[model samples]
Target: MSAVTPLLAAEELSFAYGPGQPVLREVSLAVAPGESLGLVGESGAGKTSLLRLLLGLSAPTGGRVVFEGHALDRRSAATMRKFRQAVQPVYQDPFSSLDPRMTVGESIAEPLRSLRVTGDRAARAARVAELLTAVDLPADAATRYPDAFSGGQRQRIAIARALAPKPRLILADEPLSALDTSVRMHVIELFQRLAREQGIGMLLVSHDLTIVSALCGRMAVLESGRIVEEGPTGQLLTEPQHPYTRRLLASVPRLPG
Candidate 1:
């Protein structure tokens, strides 16, 4: 565990859709400042539900999420606003996450405008340009629509938007799942750079161990809506103690030599 306060944490968390259909149970995890924690699991394992709870998008039926030593209070406007400014999310589908009617610049600036981040119009526009450049997008990308770019480029734009707020933590839900194999590598590199150079913490949820391993130092495996195992990425992946963790590792695809 990190000595410093965690950026985000879920304590004894649980959730369900309808009666007798639980999605998560007693799940707990944390992302420390400048750290990356990968949550991995098979489909229907409740990874997304856990993520939603962590993000304060949905209230937990059992436990609570804590951010920066305070319990999340979605009902309090002040608390929610501060939380929104601190945590940014990168959804799996870049196409759907972005507005079709808005230009890329407008999309990136939306958080700044809505969050009331300190800046005049020109300052925000300059920040948008900086973010685009950081994400390896050209300045002209701001004027283009989402359809004007490839899937990889769109995800980069989404990343740029997420970084625009200078968030303390990033909640990424299968960010690379929607991209091609060739593109996933570059996107993963971008995430690593955020952790390494930018000093940002991330809660990256993915089913692929290899992808997460490339970026996260710690990892937790979810099975049947519960955390079955967790530890350093290399140790846990190489010597998985839980049967489910072992099974997940065995499922990863390898290249033909």
Candidate 2:
């Protein structure tokens, strides 16, 4: 199956750290070619757990996870490597994601190096600089350290690093949650641009429904480990059918009358 196909799927997925302590309760979701789905919920509502399951990081305690229409088993050396190559994840904190000791340039280019991109060091550095520009950062950013950049700028660096692999799907966990409120909106917009322009399907796990509603075409609201409401973001937000979803929608701060 191709990455452009209904590339990733999870059916009735449930997981937990211990017996009788499920974190995800039969959470079913999918990401087809060029699609973005936002999963939103309060802390401990299994948002992060669900993201991990979708990315084939943790084995699903129940149900199955299918990538490129193939069910995953940890031991399949070839299949596991293929899955890893096709699916990449962007963490919430850029500073922590990068090795402080490594220069920003090195951090972004490491994936290519690991993949054995038979090129001279100069070629790799050029590629890294190109990616940095793609995320709206300066080429000089390649020489600087993550500590030298602001929170928003560091996230752009993280995004550049995530894009280095040219993966089909990116699982972003609260990617913009760490930035200041003023800078959060810009990062969210950058994600929207990447999803549409790159056709990079994203499983965005976040608690900010406002951001989800703005960037996502569809969203699932998790409550008590289950998806309480899901549909087109516009419809769900305006006319949520589930009580929990309604509560979530109502809780979003509204502008003054």
Which candidate's TM-score is highest? Answer: 1
lDDT of model 1, residue 199? 93
- Model 2, 62-115: lDDT tens digits are 999888777877778777767766788899887688888888999999887776
Per-prediction TM-score to the true structure, in the order listed:
0.97, 0.93
How many clashes in candidate 2? 0
Candidate 2 regions off by >4 Å? 1-5, 117-120
> Model 1: runs farther than 4 Å from truth?
none
Which pairs clash in model 2? none
Quote model 2's TM-score.
0.93
The lDDT, on a scale of 0 to 1, for candidate 2 is 0.84
Q: Mark the 10 consecutive residues where model 2 has the least summed lDDT.
A: 111-120
Each model's total of backbone clashes: 0, 0
For candidate 1, write residues 1-257 as lDDT tens digits: 84888878999999988899999999988888888899999999999888889888888999899989889998999898899888999999977888989999999999999898946999899999999988888999999999999999999999999898899889999999999999998998888887788899888899988888898899999999999899999999889999999888888887888
